[model samples]
Target: MTSIRRRLLLSLFGLWITVWAAVALTTLDRSGHEVGELMDAQMAQLARVLREISLTDPQPAAKATPQALSAVGHPYESKLSYQRWLGDRLVASFGVAPVTPLAATIGFSDQEFGGARWRVFGLPGNAPDEVLFVAQSDTIREELIHFLTIQALKPILWSLPVSVLLMWLAVGEGLRPLYRLARSIGRRSAERLEPIDGDGVPAEIRPLTAALNDLMERLDQALAAERRFAADASHELRTPFAIIRTYAQIARRSGDPAERQAALDNLIRGVDRASRLISQLLILARLQGEPRATGRGVASLVRAAARVVADWQTDAQAAALTLTAAAAEGEPGVVAVPAAALGILIGNLVENGLKYTPPGGWVQVAIGSGRGSVALRVTDSGPGIPAADRERVFDRFYRPPGQAQPGSGLGLAIVRRICDLYGLRIEIRDGADGVGLSVLVIFPEPSGSPKAHPP
Candidate 1:
């Protein structure tokens, strides 16, 4: 149930206590040695002093006068002691325990004799005194060692709880940045992918924040691309889809042979239009970062559009639609595009223009180059897209509002996708004094002028 901080504090506290305990034990041993030496020295000094005092006076008797001896060695109030001896008998004393084993030899402070414990030391007297002895106990040394051990250990034990509190505060402070990041993230919605500000984040957490921001940017781009695709597809497919439905209903209800055949023809054309729109949708997918469209080699815009235009003329004439091609004489005939892709690019433009133009309306295709670039244009005399809807018309499956054209709406999307693949640019605008829409494609003239493959 103990937390990490408490556990660490306890561990440290226990280690410190163990260490100090060892130190205290070692101190006790040393204290015994020093106290023993001090007791021996004091006892020796007292015994020698007693002997000198006993023998220094003028005395003919070998033994000190009993009164004189007693005066010198009565019980001293402090730990000090002195005793006098005859040849083999105790004569006078100071602080003498009743059962002290005081003898001729120097004695230890822990000796026992009779019925009591004593500390005693004996020394030889001068000319007249036979021997003098001194002794004291170690009670004071034991009390002092116990007091020091208690004082030194009290502070170390009491400091652990306070140390644990400080440690918890530091840990929480260190994690404050993470808390801030979490709160910031919690405030965001699923649709919000804006990058978070990473300034002032700790070095250890910077990479994490940066990674999340990168993910948000990618999600934003993906969502935008998806929205664009949906809007574009909805716009492009609406026209033909309506045409197919209307003609189908007409065919279903009509009993007149000629009217039914006309409705069937319109329905067939609607199917073709739907097919073209679907193909353009596929191209748009390719243009949106697909790997298959990568590295489409360059070709001549003149030759590429010529082939597409020729095929479109066969269809345009069959539909009683007018088609034309215009190009500069002996000028550069090359455009930067892949050969196969070039056909789809021009064919879609020409076909769309022909389909939307009235029976007599003309579709003009042109190719020309100067100033390090080639320009390809498809111009038509059909009802042109309004200036306001020019950009929107380029969206996949998009047909301008109120547009009555019977073609797939993806013609411009196909044109835009191809342009992107070849590093070309395209725009739709009023043609020849704002007559009908003219779709323009400008291709960059590459250095070393890439050779055009024969189509």
Candidate 2:
């Protein structure tokens, strides 16, 4: 695996090396040019000095055979040579093969003599027929250039280790914050969902830290909700089971047939209550577990409400209550919800209303669409919820005091959860004459293709 720190270090080191290489190349080039210019100047100066010496000589030597100068001299002097031409005769020569007119051109020139390349500077002699030339072998200048280049690069080559060490240290120091953040996360307990501290964190990584904190907050809430649900379920189910056991014992001990029958009936009622509570508990759990609605297709609110009324018609009649459903005329009565979700929502509301309302009372389920909103409203001619108790009614297993109703108190809670999942808005108010409860669920505009249907 490739490490981030290693990559960063390598990138920085490569950049530094590249920059140094460029500078070194430029320095070497400049040093070669300057050294060449100095050597050329020395050759020209030697030529001038030879011309002056030949002009001042009063007894010029007679022309003789060419002779090689001594090999022992200053390290550079052995490479130097001079030639003088007087009227087409070699008057003097040193350290090199005799050659007439060492260079055909006048100023500075390069020529091969004695199997070696030389830099030659030719000067006009004081006498019109005399010519002077001073030449140095190319090897001498190359040696000097090589020496100077090595000297120039010594500092950079020697400092490389120190520079690399410093770079490594700097990179490590720069990354300390990230290391601390990683350690902080690694040290956390699994159950600890608290947000991480943002203090001392680098600005570049703030977004990452913020996202982590947001996720932790959400997880904390979910865990808390789960814990609360478990506690409530255990507490609520305990009571019904205890009553069922008590009634069963009473039936076993009773001697009169009618008394025993009454005890059995109570036991059955207790069992039924426990069964309903368990069923509601499972439904609530499923509703919480399922993913939230995406409003993928339009569901007919009128159809869902009418279906709930039809299914509950017998129950309504058994309770001696009139339950009815209607849709507004000339409206699609569509909403952005699934058909099953709409049915569950309406069914819970109508069931709650039927269970609470007195005999001869009415429960109305209506679907209306207007003003860019679709609403499913359930009105019951029952004792209305007090204004203070409206919000608390949505809590799990919370029942109002002084209400002698056989209920698990989960119907409205389930409806509220469904509304929250689908982004629906619910409102509670007094029914007609302020004597009953009115529950209204408002949904956003219909999504996808909506099909109109009658109630």
- Each model's lDDT comes to 0.72, 0.86
Residue lDDT tens for model 2, 1-455: 98988999999889989988997888788878998899999888888888888767845688755564555757666678888888777788877745666788778999888789988888888888888888899999888888888888889889899999999999898889889988888876658877889999999888989998887787777778788899999999999999999989999999989999999999999998999899899989888766567575677787788789999999999999999988867667777888887888899999999999999999999888778888888999999899999999999999989889888889989999999888889999999788799999998886455555522
Q: Residue 296 in model 2: shift from native, Å?
A: 8.4
TM-scores for every candidate against the unseen true structure:
0.49, 0.69
lDDT of 1 at 363: 92
Please list the residue runs of candidate 2 whose C-alpha ends up more than 4 Å from where it truly belongs after superposition.
32-70, 73-149, 178-216, 243-276, 282-344, 358-365, 369-372, 418-424, 433-435, 445-455
User: Which residue segments of model 1 deviate by more than 4 Å?
Assistant: 1-197, 200-219, 231-263, 289-296, 329-332, 383-389, 396-402, 420-422, 428-437, 452-455
The 10 consecutive residues of candidate 2 with the worst lDDT sum are 446-455
Candidate 2 clash pair list:
none
User: In angstroms, how far off is 322's CA in candidate 1?
Assistant: 4.0
Best TM-score among the predictions, by candidate number: 2
